[model samples]
Target: MSAPVQVGPSSSSGGPAPLEDLEDLLADIGDRVRAERQFRGWTQAELAQRAQLGTVALSSLERGRPTLLSTLVLACTALGVDLAHVMSSDWREPERGPSMTPQQAVVLREAAAGGSLTEIGARLDMTAAEVGSTLTRVYQRLEVTHVPRAERRAAAVRMAVQHGLITPQKRTS
Candidate 1:
């Protein structure tokens, strides 16, 4: 019922996939999403609500129509499924048009290192509100602003790490 979403370059070779391959991938994701929702006994409306999405959006996704990365993430989150379950780990986020600035990198690095907004701002001589706004801008640059605000930090940080903007820190006991 949904139109196939076009995919960008593949992560492995940084080249575009054949259109049919992309279509197959989208169909697979739709099938998996539908299965997950049914497993939980949720109707389209119920899953949409849990994902903070509209039913039409959910329907489009389930029908293997054009899907947004943010929509897929939100639905996967609500379904308590890992992205790996729905997509290949090798599948990277499509390239966003703008590059990250050095200041934005610093902000994301601090956040990834577990600094709170207040702490990051204090060290950077900015107000917490200013830090939040900066992060918002960074999210925009990363094209992840469509994700819920609560989930943006994690999403952006993951992207930053993938882009070599920051290295993930090791956890200490």
Candidate 2:
């Protein structure tokens, strides 16, 4: 026979009760972690071994026990959760803005041409320091760590397409 379940005292009774909000949050986190681990086909013992943590600690964490930030980070790392995805404030790609000024576009193109920052700046009638600062802001707006050559080309192409600087072509046989 199944044992009878005991219900805890409710908050309405003004007696000691479970912290529902905290409990719910912990339960949600636990559910996510458990689901991810299970989806990866990892048993608690295997996960513990791979994470280099004790099975009991792993179990407690999986069960949503309050754990240290370092412990949680270690566990997440072991589970292949890119900490950057959690820590980054903005992950989504931002909407493209208006095309940059002609001078700015020229500066970007020159930079993309593999010229030194100083050379590009000189060609664009700007100082190397100014060019560096401008590039930093541009990169931040673009949401990329470092612009690749192909990405620079793509940006130029996009700008040209947007400003009617380049005409669309029909496909041919």
Candidate 3:
């Protein structure tokens, strides 16, 4: 991982550095927001529009400049990420729940193997809508939003490694 960016104190000539820990926290949050935005293929301008904020404001927040709580919440909402998760102090291992059942694992594996919702549903003897709903719940439990194709595969790969299911390798490139 790249070294965390440092914000200097603001001086008379420029400005003193803000509180170090707070600045670092904000910077970390900003980086995560930027990454998620990029993952979703959205521009700062688009995020700003969706968040009902000026482009400059959005830019400032993305730069880790001091910003209002409401603005941060709005920006995170627009990015389809939970602000609470982003702001939480805990960055340790994510809590693991009961492993998925064999049937559910098969469903996930098929989906991860690039099977369309309809195809996976047919294979699992479920309706497309039901498959979609189950997948949504899985994503929620994983605390993931907007799973890129690669991430979907990774999730499956992780499940397999954990002995939950076996899935084919996913093509990420």
Candidate 4:
């Protein structure tokens, strides 16, 4: 993976973004919007209609101008990606992200790979018990708290994949 993009408050600057950073950030966001729209095989006009936005506004946003939150939400919702995912590439926003955290998404993505808790924990650099506890929280959040332990992993994995939170795990050499 490419090195994670640095976003949010700058550690060095720690203050207002210079005009340059602002422009760069907007362009970056616009690129993400464009990519997702294209990946979905959507014409700009099609997404604009779905987002209830004017094609002009969509074009402007794609050009990386700071726009309204409603505009951002409409774009993300149309693309089936999380707003948080756009803000910080680390997280997958599940349909709506209110029910989960970035850390939770990471853990769930790892779990979906099909492994015992111990093995998953080893990969995650956590203890097996941490994996179980984390998954328990995920289940509760997903409202599948009653799903039996035997099936929870598969079920959560399926949920994640269906929500576009994670791709189904694939084996590779």
Candidate 5:
């Protein structure tokens, strides 16, 4: 199997983005996919069925692992989000903000992966309330608490992904 990609910032000159840059870009795209999916209250399987993609494929793409561009286009279309907006390379706003703590990142990542608060809390050795509180703090830190209460989780995941706190995890499924 090929080595997993490493996610980082893009190069300024922009000849060909380094492998790390590509990794970051994929993760960014994945974040957008996850955020959109969450915003619509769709699970990976639901989106996958809509897009005619496999659940594993959708999961991999949402986790920021490398995926075919066509698959991404399919998912974007299925989610009803503009492809260009989701694929934008400009990450300036989040990059300028403070970074999230490791715990915060883990919490956001698990949420983006569609983990229930209780499930995530169990995995992290915390109670569901603690998980919810951590997510609330993340929303405050990312300044996204102003978002509608129902959408706050999605917003936090999107912002955390943009801030580079949530890189692609190794393929686990």
Candidate 6:
């Protein structure tokens, strides 16, 4: 069985919770995480160790800054908070389609870096045709047909970035 996904209490005034912006959403989830941590009498350091994250990362998350998806998931898992709630925010994609598989996400991220489909296939040990098929599905997920086939790759990347699925690879000198 899965762990219970804890959600916030609804407004006492009988109105839907107002997630006015990204900051509000982050604050809401962070507050819940803090509450859960306090209820168990665990320090942020304790939870950080449990989550296999640094105390600094935990602090950043608690401060409502942009963070890695993995960090967010780890925090939720460690804190026993719903992963959905942590990821919920106004920054969500407005035109999401069927959820992409990890493989599909890999393909999209590879393509996002300006790699040709065949080049991506070479990196993944997949054939060019296979990469093309995978991209077709990604396009469907992002609803980018209006952008033309050749241009959909860039648009899909934008959507993925907007949805926080993948971040640009950081360069190291």
Please provide TM-scores, in order, for all candidate models, with all chains considered together. 0.41, 0.30, 0.33, 0.44, 0.44, 0.45
lDDT of 6: 0.70
* CA RMSD of each candidate after superposition: 16.0, 18.1, 18.6, 14.7, 20.5, 13.7
The C-alpha stretches of model 1 lying farther than 4 A from their native spots are 1-98
Per-residue error for 10 in candidate 5, Å, reads: 5.5
| TM-score winner | 6
Give the per-residue lDDT of model 4 (tens digit) for 1-173. Answer: 12223333344634322223445656777888899999999999999999999999999989876678446555654554445668786765344642556777788888877688899899999999998999888887776767888888778777766655666677897
Off by over 4 Å in 5: 1-16, 19-95, 168-173
Separate clash counts for every candidate: 2, 0, 9, 0, 0, 0
Q: Tens digits of per-residue lDDT for model 3 on 90-144?
A: 6354555535566666667777666778988898899999898877665554545
Q: Which candidate is the best by lDDT?
A: 1
Q: What is the per-residue lDDT of model 5 for residues 1-173, given as tens digits with 9 covering 90 to 100? A: 12334222224532222343455566677888899999999988899999999999899887777679646655654443444656687523322674678888888888777778999898889899999999888888999989998888888877776655675546687
lDDT (C-alpha) at residue 76 in model 1: 54
Point out where model 6 deviates above 4 Å. Answer: 1-98, 171-173
Which residue runs does candidate 2 get wrong by more than 4 Å? 1-20, 69-86, 89-173
Q: In terms of TM-score, how similar is model 2 to the real structure? A: 0.30
lDDT of each: 0.74, 0.58, 0.64, 0.72, 0.72, 0.70
Clashes of 4: 0
- Alpha carbon deviation, residue 29, candidate 5 (Å): 35
Residue 24 of model 2 has an lDDT of 44
Q: After superposing candidate 3 on the true structure, give the runs of residues whose Cα lies further than 4 Å from its correct spot.
A: 1-98, 146-150, 156-173
RMSD of 1: 16.0
Q: After superposition, how far is residue 100 of candidate 6 from its true place, in Å?
A: 1.2
For residues 15-64, write the lDDT of model 2, one tens digit per residue: 32333344444455667777888999999889888889999887876676
lDDT of 6 by residue, 57-136 (tens): 88877776667744554454444445566566833444644467899999888877667778899998999999999989
What value does the lDDT take at residue 2 in candidate 4?
A: 21
